[model samples]
Target: MAALQGAVETTAPVSRLHEQRSYDPADFGVPTGREEEWRFTPLRRLRGLHTDAPLPGGKVTVECDPAPEVTVENIERGNRRLGTAYVPADRVSARAFTSFAEATVVTVPRGVVASRPTVISVRGDDPAGAVFGHVVVELEPLAQAVVVLDHTGSATYADNVELIVGDGATLAVVSLQDWASDTVHLSHHHAQVGRDARFTHTAVTLGGSVVRLAPSVRYAGPGGEAELRGLYFADAGQHLEHRLFVDHGERNCRSRVTYKGALQGADAHAVWIGDVVIRAEATGTDTYEYNRNLVLTDGTRVDSVPNLEILTGEVVGAGHASASGRLEDHHLFYLMARGIPYDEARRLVIRGFFGQLIAQIEVPELHARITSAVEAELA
Candidate 1:
């Protein structure tokens, strides 16, 4: 419920890693719920993804229908293109990296524009087994494309996704997590934006037992732009968490982030953590992040934190906003005064709250589907 608009200065030598990124899982200690990173998480529910337990893989399936101009491949661990655009910053991410058997790669050729969006589906068949996965999406120089990533079914899943946006290219990605009620999923998506490229990513998470997602962005050269947006609704006993980081290391770059969520029923929890760091050399960087949460019931809880770190005062502008509270009583009163039933008025308020964000995405089908899903949740 706090908003941070200023910068923080460091005097002595600081760690090179922003959040202690590492490739080896052994570099990270197991979680005991005492560390700052794991404080808000329920560690006992992770089912050994953070520990040394065996990741024998599970009944996980991946299906992709790529555009004619795109190339899709199933690559092994030693593939040259692997790990080129991302690094793991947490224990689960490192574990998913080292344990995933294969990686799915979707590539859009240089200078080619895809006519249709590329669709990829990841589903789990067994809730008892564990799944570790890796996904890579690349757009070469001057290429343009859209990617749709959907997840469903149930399992204990952890994975990492890499997005490479080349120079002067434009890339849009929509990631949807509609898992079953018994599913537990953890994922991290990182984007490497090249010079003058544009990248947009939207995350829609509506169902899960325990889901945690991290999306991050970094610039490879100057003039790159990135936008991250998300929406989620949690029911009783469902926990949804999203953490985002933007590293502005290049000059004249721009980044924006906005996320909104709603919670209902008892014991529903949501967490949002947004961090933006503007380095000293990153002059003329313009960035802003925002998050808002709505509590539809009494037993639900939410935690929203927005942080900004500007190492140099020469930047263009930087700021953030975060707020969490119940629905505005005046808005409801205004609707109820029109002869609308109490329940119908509540639905209208919630719909208007999320409909704005849903319309921001360029995809058409997602707009309708998410609206229908929200209506079902309200019912």
Candidate 2:
């Protein structure tokens, strides 16, 4: 479908559609739950983070284990490479930008393909308090790398992450949230994919009092590809949310998003929002996004919304879908018909739901660990 190929300029912003872009915190103001973006979120669990309360001393300690060839730098606020990939899009992200005292930058030099993953571990300290952090990952042209970000323990944390993959580069990012039940985390992640580059972002959320993560991707040039995958489990009294946006402003770009979640016990809540925009000039764009949720028990809630806006019919393809429901009785019945016990049958169904995405993870150790944790939750 090349109906509108190269027919219009891509820089014009329509005033009717509310755009979520700004470097100033005041532009977003304070979220009072009445705003469309913040309506699904529980602001009370944020512990005054959205307001003017000053960020306390850091309670989360961060350490990086880089590959032998990689370079890790703890830079000051004004470093030249800090904001190249992303900017603050909301009040909390803007606040994180203004509050963080220092920033961490990890650089993968041009054309260096890493053999081992660059792991960054963030652990919470005792006497948990509010914490703010910023991390920037830069990959030069033709570089290939896998970066893992692990979060554990407990704290009230807010952070911003920026990922830049240069032209002809390949980058895979895995971010896991394995926090204690008392922890609350809010984060914004932005990725800029260069010409003919490939980028994959995988997020796994398992434990938290309230966790909301926003991931946005934009192409710096045409011929870029982006794949976003996520898996989450919500237990009793837990809230987990994931919001994503993929902007297709460049021609010949492609994106695919798939996220699955399971909920059990009372008061478990999960929210997923997938948004994709295809501009008139982006004629060769191909995009699809979908989210699925399985409810394992009563008193659980799930919200899934998929939105697609296409300014031109010239694009190759564009579509979105969302589904939420309890496990299929036929799936469990099929296993039980084979003489398997009821508990084991239920577990198998949940495992099968997540297994497909888990298998996509390239790290064997992380794959085994995540499978074990999912089993523990089912137990």
Candidate 3:
């Protein structure tokens, strides 16, 4: 419901962090949930990742498989491409950046098309400690590849991920959060699109005590394209949040974003925030963002916010929409009227809602897993 055409200035020091971008953790201070960005988040469940508390170690295990056309390495933080995609935009992200000594970097050479997907598996070893990690993905000119980040187990974890897509290159990234019921995770993903490049970001969140993921994109050159998609399920007493921001500063760029979530049981909560900004110089831009949330039962809560700011009237088009509500009784009645069982009818409706996005992934194994997870949630 909120939109801004120009920069917003605030008097409070904590409020300024919402607009400031920095790599130093000191610049953000600590969030009190009163700031514009953190108001919807449950900061008390973050396990001190935002404050001066120490970031625990040895709580997470990460493994990666190197592909023939792609190179994966645990490089020192001094690597030139470490922060090329994005810098820390908040306190937790800044803390994560400062805590990790090395970053996992995946690089695809120029003009090379990867034959197989590069998979990174991250699992929590214990639930008592906190973990901080970083990941960087770089694609050279005309390169194409897919990267999957699979996370599971139980722990307090925070991470920063960056993706750099070069001119004419294509990159797709999938982040799956299937954790233990008690796990807590916070992550920030940033992507930079080069001239004529293509980027796709997908997120699947199904577990955790409190999980929040922020994915942002900025055009590095003209004619870039970005697609962002997400799906999540929230159970009783669980909190899930996904926030996205796309900044179009170059000419002739295009972006599309779609996110859908389902919630059931008492006290389950889901939040989605989508923001798109088109600068005055971003002529010939085309963008649309939408979010849909399905409340499957009583006592569950959903908050959806979609915002678009256009500083130029020369842009091709720009728009955003958000919808949150329970399933329609007419849909169920229509199906049951054909002699179909109630349970089967409900399942069909749920599947149909998410089928479009799932099919877009084009990965059968992932699709199966997502459906199975949702079925288990419904059971």
Candidate 4:
């Protein structure tokens, strides 16, 4: 680790270029395996990768059938900011910092409603090195759009992304993380909602050696709404963790979060932490969060912590719930006695567990794709 640090410090030209054109891992305060937030995660797994961050050579492609009438821009060389906060050095870990970059920017003008989904695909080849990329979204007042982000790598690398949505706009953002077998992924997504704006985020994690996804959203204006939805599967010895924070900074705002996971095989571990905060001035706030996990093997483990903090008494409603357990024997037996194959029966039960949330997606094609991917991973 020290050698890698020294290499980054010694490479003056590359370091300067990274600073001028892209996000530096060092700026985010990469973890040294000593921080409390990183205690549960294994840091030694990143020892083999090259410490020096790679240039933004990865290819980013966008596709939208029946494309939107609004202007679509692909920003190749530009500084993209995620909301108003700069990348604080102490808040970022070394591994997490390597994956930061200024992503392509997409802007939707006010009052424009897109007719099709916008698909953004990013691909990289530095499996043994570090890869960084970013995607910036700005929606004008009364604008409506659906954006899909798909991340995949040919080699093992850490990935990071930052997203921003504007005021009085509605953005339906979906993210899919599919990395190589030996890949280690660390992702950070930060979003801000403006007055009367709506932001919906849905994430599906299906492949990676070790994956940690953290999404932080803030409702900074009155009457704004934010919704977070996610589905994950950890099989065999994989480790997957998701942490979400929703901040209500204004009055008359609402937020809802629901995340579910399935764990199978020994040493498969999954962790979920949901945190919601209603500020003192945030009156008429409504928030709720729930996390559920289904354990298929005795050796598998899951830890869930759902929390809510209210600083004012004028809030309308707030609550949180968490549950972690195995499949009920009665439900399994009943399925088997009905002549269903054991494997098929187990698959049915797992699908039903996530089906409720999957059914909530407004897009038919997206809903079907998510369901098929979950089935394939669990099967």
TM-scores, all candidates, are 0.95, 0.94, 0.94, 0.83
The reply for model 3, stretches above 4 Å from the true place, is: 1-18
Estimate every model's Cα lDDT from 0 to 1: 0.87, 0.85, 0.86, 0.68
Candidates' RMSD to native: 3.0, 5.8, 3.8, 8.5
Measured on C-alpha atoms, candidate 4 has an lDDT of: 0.68
Better of 1 and 4 by TM-score: 1
| Tens-digit per-residue lDDT, 1-379, candidate 2 | 1111111212324212237666567777899997666777899889877887675665888899998878999987767767767878778888877777678788999999988999999887642568888999899999999999999998888889999999999989999999988988999989999999999999999988999998889899999999999999999989999988898889999999999999899989888878788887888999999888888888887878776778878888888767777888888899999999999999999999999999998666799999998999999
Per-residue lDDT over 1-379 for candidate 1, one digit per residue giving the tens place of the 0 to 100 score:
2322222232322224365878898999987887655666777777777888775557889899999999999998868789888988888998889888899999999999999889999988987889889999999999999999899998899999999999999999999999998888999999999999999999999988888998999999999999999999989988898988899999999999999999899988887878788989999999999888888887887777676778888888898888777888888899999999889999999999998999988678789998999899999
Residues 54-149, candidate 3: write the lDDT tens digits. Answer: 755657888887568898889776677677678889999988888877789999999999988898888997877788889989999999999999
Mark the regions of model 2 whose C-alpha exceeds 4 Å error after superposition: 1-18
Model 4 root mean square deviation, Cα atoms: 8.5
Backbone clash pairs for candidate 2 read none
- Model 2's C-alpha root-mean-square deviation from the true structure amounts to 5.8
lDDT of 2 at 377: 93
Residue 356, model 1, lDDT: 90
Q: What does candidate 4's lDDT look like per residue over 28-126, in tens digits?
A: 444666543555567676543324433334333334332365565544433334423323222333334434444456777878888877777766455
Better candidate number, 3 or 4, judged by TM-score = 3
lDDT of 2: 0.85
